[model samples]
Target: MMAKKYSNKINKIRSFALALIFVGFIIMYAGIFFRGNPIVMLIFIILGMLSLVFSMVVYFWIGLLSTRAVVVNCPNCDKPTKILGRVDMCMHCREPLTLDPELEGKEFDEDYNKKSRQTKQT
Candidate 1:
């Protein structure tokens, strides 16, 4: 099987936020073409603004998560990166990393983090 590409959670979310901004702008521009219908244009503009607001919220959330993320140097890439959960990818090299020693040298699996969280609640 081919190797699955994994992304750094923070970087992924940041990309999403960037995409949202572009989408919001596109939506707002679409509103301009609907100038004939004042109500439609108003709705589109409001929706666009809402999208931008949501993006800001997501960005803020990433900031909060960043405060909790663990910073470590990647063994494979020899670069600094942040690990958000028990398992996360290296931001610089996309190398799979784990905070748990037991998981070291094991295949990468996102479910490891989810399982850890579930066990904590039980």
Candidate 2:
């Protein structure tokens, strides 16, 4: 079986926020089709606005997480990358990296970041 592709956590969250924006805009556009029904149009508009506002909140959260992420130089690509959890991938090369020596050379698993596993790593 082929190994699963992993992406930098920050990039994943960032992309999700972007997707939310697109979805919100699409929802608002759909509201135009219901212009004859003011109540239905209003509902769609409000829901779309909520989606947009939530996306902004997610963006702000990622910004805060960025400040706390650990920065390290990727051994494979020799480029700097940020690690948000116990296990993460290099943003440039997608090399699996771990902060725990015990996990080094092991198969890359995102579950290593879970609170239950964090205690084991420590």
Candidate 3:
């Protein structure tokens, strides 16, 4: 079996926000089918606009979080990337990264980032 691939948290959140934008537009376009029924069309359009507004909020939130994230060059790819948690995949190469020295050179596991897990280890 192939190992599961992990994505950087920042990239993942951004991707989700971008997808929401597309979904919102698609929903609005679908409203065109109900043009004869003004009420239904208006409802669909309103829902789509809500989705778009929510996406904008998400983007803004992530943007602020990104400014606070740790930036480091990936050892594998030699490119700058942001790390959101203790363990995160590289943005350019998906290589596992860690801020804690104790966890270095070990198998990549998301559980390592959990506070409960670290406290147990200690």
In candidate 3, what are the lDDT values of residues 44-83, reduced to their tens digit? 9998999899999999999999999999999999999999
lDDT by residue for model 2 over 1-122, one digit each (tens)?
99677899999999999999999999999999999999999999999998999999999999999999999999999999999988999999899998888888899999998998877767
Steric overlap count per candidate:
0, 0, 0
lDDT of 3 at 10: 87
**TM-scores of the models, in the order given:** 0.90, 0.92, 0.92
- Candidate 1 weakest lDDT stretch, 10 residues: 113-122
| Model 3 spans > 4 angstroms off | none
The residue pairs found clashing in candidate 2 are: none
lDDT of 3 at 122: 91
Superposed Cα RMSD, model 1:
2.4
Ranking by lDDT: 2, 3, 1
lDDT of 3: 0.92
Q: What lDDT score belongs to each candidate, Candidate 1 first?
A: 0.91, 0.93, 0.92
The residue pairs found clashing in candidate 3 are none
Candidate 1 lDDT over 1-122, as tens digits, reads 99777899999999999999999999999999999999999999999999999999999999999989999999998999999888999998899999888778888888877966548645
TM-score-superior candidate, 1 or 2:
2
